[model samples]
Target: MRLKVLTCLVAVAALYAPQASAGSKIRVETRTYDVTGASGIELIQNINRKGPKRGFMAHAIALTAYSASWDLVMLRRNGSCRVRQANGTMDLVFTFPRVVSPMSPALKRRWSRFMAGTHAHEATHGRLARDMMRAAERSAVGLETTDDPSCSKARREAGRRIEAVSAQYEAKQKAFDVTEHRGGGHVEHLVLALIKP
Candidate 1:
């Protein structure tokens, strides 16, 4: 009886050991948007899905920069992928609920911009999240050594690069907003401006 109980306990411990070890890993959630109508729910869903990619990517890079900070990753992507209504106004606009995090003030600012960048920026977050998750998984599986200083440095560098790209995206967003409000009526230019640097 003692031997059987000990074996059962060992098996249970083995089953849970990996789970306990991986508790610190980040979680990521991604949503894709395709709105077929102008329904309010559909519009909100579309915007929410599209608005967070760049910000999320920026957030990831920030985490990599510090080599700390673990939290779930959320990415929203897809742009104002609709055409002008017959009434000649924006067919749709996107809005995502603000996220509150314990990140530093600087990180918070970057995250806000990233969240506010063009819808396409969300796609960047999706890509970055995948890459980060893969790296984390590899480390967890023992394929990569987390303790390597080189690994830490590489992550920091990658974070910085992503931030630079995000900044450009932000600037373009600002420019587009300006041109849009001026009644320039340049649809193609506005779309291009949103996604391009």
Candidate 2:
């Protein structure tokens, strides 16, 4: 799962030029915390206890954190100010569990498979975060004020749009989690398989 990081980080940041390609894609940073166990049950226990605690209360099997930074440019002429460009970058950090104990080859294989699926799920969140940033940039670029020469109005408008975009994307992320977390769904299946005796 991904952190519901504040998308409207600052409402708006002032800048000028065409949209830049700074944070369009994710350069994921993956970190693993060692989980100790020799069997599936023990390994599962360690994971449950040692996994990142970024969720509501219980620990998350894996977690992805996201943040967006924007580079905005404004063009003003004839007492009209408009966004000339907006380049928003998304940064993703992922936390996962690693097995550090000796286990049977069969168990090792199972652990690998489980981790693979878990990583894929977290990656989906990362992609969603990137999409959200792109949407935010689009909203910023579409902002303009025909009379606000000082660009105050334009800045305010951009801020509002950024908030809206962030809210919209947060909803999307929650919906995705709902689908994956439903009974007998993808997430449940992966978890059950990993903890199976």
Query: Each candidate: what lDDT?
Result: 0.30, 0.76
Report the C-alpha lDDT of model 1 over 1-197, residue by residue, as the tens digit. Answer: 00000000000101112132322233333333332213323333444444334343321111111122322111111211111010100011122334332445554454344444433443343334334334432332321223333233333433343344434534544454355335544423433343332
- Report the lDDT tens digits of candidate 2 across residue range 1-197: 76866453333334444445443555568899999887777887887788888655578789988777665567777778887666666668899998777878788888888888898999888878878877887888767789877877887788778778888988988898889888988877887786676
Off by over 4 Å in 2: 8-27
How do all models score by TM-score? 0.24, 0.88
Report per-prediction Cα RMSD to one decimal: 22.3, 2.6
The prediction achieving the highest lDDT against the true structure is: 2
Error of 1 at 152 (Å): 1.5
TM-score of 1: 0.24
